[model samples]
Target: MSSAEDLQFKILQHPNPTSPEKRVELMANPTFGRVATDHMVMIRYTEGKGWHDAQVMPRGPLSLDPSAAVLHYAQEIFEGLKAFRTKDDGIAIFRPDANARRFRSSAERMAMPQLPESLFVRAVDELVKADRDWVPSGENASLYIRPFMFANDAFLGVKPASEYMFLVIAAPVGAYFSAGAVTVWVSETYTRAAPGGTGAAKCGGNYAASLLAQAEAKHHGCDQVVFLDAVHHRFVEEMGGMNIFFVFEDGSIRTPPLTGTILPGITRESLLTIAKEKGIKAHEEPYTIDQWLEDARSGRLTEVFACGTAAAVSPIGAVRTKDGEVKIGDGTGAGPVTASLKESLIAAQRGQANDHHHWVHRVL
Candidate 1:
C-alpha cells in the first residue's frame, strides 16, 4: 500500500467520442444525471495493496461479481458536486478539496478504504479534463460530477469489505427544480437519520430509506419531504436530500444543527461562511416543527430554503403537514435573502464574484 501521492492516472481516450454537433444538442438542455460524458475515472482499492489501478477510461457498464458486497449489503457511498464553465470561458470545480475530505469521512464511517484527498481531486480533474467539452456554458447549466465508492468484496458477509472500487462520472445538467419556490411535505411516518446512525454519511442506504418517504411527499402533491429527528420526531432535521435553512423577519437565519443526524452539505457550509462574511447573523440551532409552523404563520419566519450540491439553493414556499398547510412569506418564490445568497454562491462558483475563500478549483 502506497500513499495516494505516489499514484499516477492512466488516461485511456474514448474510442468513439460524441460528435461536437451531437454534444451541443445534448448540452442544450442536459437533464440531471441523464446524459453522461464519454469517459470516467476509476480507482481500485485492496486491503494489502492500498489504492491502485487508477485510470480515466471509457464510461460504460461496470462488471461485478454476483456476490459483490454492495449488491446485497449496500456498502456504498457517493458524492455530488459540479464543474462550472467560468465567466471567462474556463472551467472550474467548486471546492473539490472539501468534497474530497467529506468522501474520506464517509469512507471511514462505512468501514471502507479512505481515498487520499489528493488522489480524489486528481481523479476528478482527470475526468473533467478528458471531457472538458462536455462542460456547458450558461448561467444555470454546469457539469454535475459524481464520485462514489462501493464494497467490491465478492463474499457473503456482514463485515467491512476488503476490496473496494471508486469511480467518478459526470453529467451536464440544468436546474434541478422548475422555476419558483417549491412546496414540501412533512413526513411523520418516515425519519431520515437518528442519533448514532448513518444519517451523517452519504451512503446509498440512507437515500434508499428516504425513497418511500419521498414518494409519500409526492403522493401529497409536494415537491420534497421534510424529516424530523428520529428521537423526538418533532425537531426539524433536514430535507430528504438537502439541508434546510430558515430566515427570520429580523434578517437572522437559523438551520438545524449537525447533531450527527444530517449530511454536512458543502453548499450549506459555503452559505454559512458567506453569511458571516456579509455580517448576516446565522445560527445553527434546533427548531421544531411546531415552532416552524407557528413562526411562519405569525410572520416571524420570513423565508425558507434548501441547499445541496444537486439543487444548490431552492426556496421552500409552503409546508404541508397532516394538520394543514402553512405558507412561508406569501409562498410565491425565493425571498430577497434567499435569492441574494443563492446569487452570491453561484457567482463565486462560476467565477463571477470575488473568490475570497479560493473555493473554486480551476481545471481549465
Candidate 2:
C-alpha cells in the first residue's frame, strides 16, 4: 500500500459535456439532488492492493456483480457536503476535512477498510474542480457533493468484503425545503437507532430504516419526521436526516447529546461552535418530548430548528404528535438566534465572514 500522498488522480474529460445553454437552464431553477454535473470521481480498493485506479471520469452507471456483498449485506457508507460559490468569486468546500473524518469513522463501524482522509478529500476536490461550472451562485444555492463507498466483492458470505469502491458525484441544488419554517412530525412507531447501533455512522441502512417514518410524516402533513431514543422512546433523538435544537427565552440553546444514537452532524457542530463564540450558552443535553411541548406551550421555547448538510439550518415551525400540534414561536419563521446562527454559518461557508476556524477549504 502506498502512502496517501503517493496516490494520484487521473483526470478524464467528459466526451459529451453538457452544453452551456443547457447548464444555464438546469441551474436557473435547480432542485435538491435533481441536477447532476457531467463528471464524477472513482477510486477502487482491495485488501491486498490497497487503494488504486483513481479517476475523474464521465458520470454514469456502475457495474457490480450479481452477488456483490453490498447488495446482500448492505455494507455501504456515504457523505454529503457542498461547494459554495464564494463572495469573492471563488469556489470553496465547507469542512471537507470534517466530512473526511466522519467517512473514515463510518467505514470502521461498517467493518470495511478505511481510506486515508487525504485521499477522501482529494477525490472531492478533484470532482469539484472538474465541474466548477456547476457550482451555482445565488442565495441558498450551491453544488451538493456526494461521496460514497460500497463493498464490491462478489462473495455472498456473512463477512466483510475485500474489494470496495469509492465514488464522488455532485449536483447543483437550491434550498432543500420550501421558503419559511417547516413543520415536523414526531414518530412513536419507528425508532432510528438504538444504543451501540449504526446510528452514529453515516451509512445507508440507517436512512433505509427511517423511510417509513418519513412517509408517515408526509401522511400526517409535515415536512419531516423526528425520532426518539430507542429504549424509553421519550427523549428526542434527532430528525430523520438532521439534528434538532431548541432555543429558549433566556437566550440559551440545547440539543440532544451524542450518545452513539444520533448522527454527529457537521452543520450542527458548526452551529454549536458559532453559538459559543457569540456567548449564547449552548448545551448538548437531552430534552424529552413532553418537556419540548411544555416549553413550547409555556412560551419558554423561542425557536426550534434542524441542521444538516442537506437541510442547512431549517427552522421547525411546529411539532405534530398523536395528541395534537405544538407551534414553535408563533409557528411563523426563524427566530432571532436561529436566524443569526444561520447567517454566521453561511457567511463563513461562502467566505463572506471571518473563518476563524479555517473551516472552508478553497478549491478555486
| Best-matching candidate per lDDT | 2
Off by over 4 Å in 2: none
TM-score, each model? Answer: 0.99, 0.99
lDDT of 1 by residue, 296-318 (tens): 99999999999999999999999
The whole-model C-alpha lDDT of candidate 2 against the native structure comes to 0.95
Clashing pairs in 1: none
lDDT of each: 0.94, 0.95
Candidate 2 lDDT by residue in tens digits, 60-79: 99998999999999999999
Write down the RMSD of all candidates, one decimal each. Answer: 0.8, 0.7
- Least well predicted 10-residue stretch by lDDT in candidate 1: 347-356
Clashing pairs in 2: none
How far residue 150's Cα lies from its native spot in candidate 1, in Å, is 0.5
In terms of lDDT, the poorest run of 10 residues in model 2 is 1-10
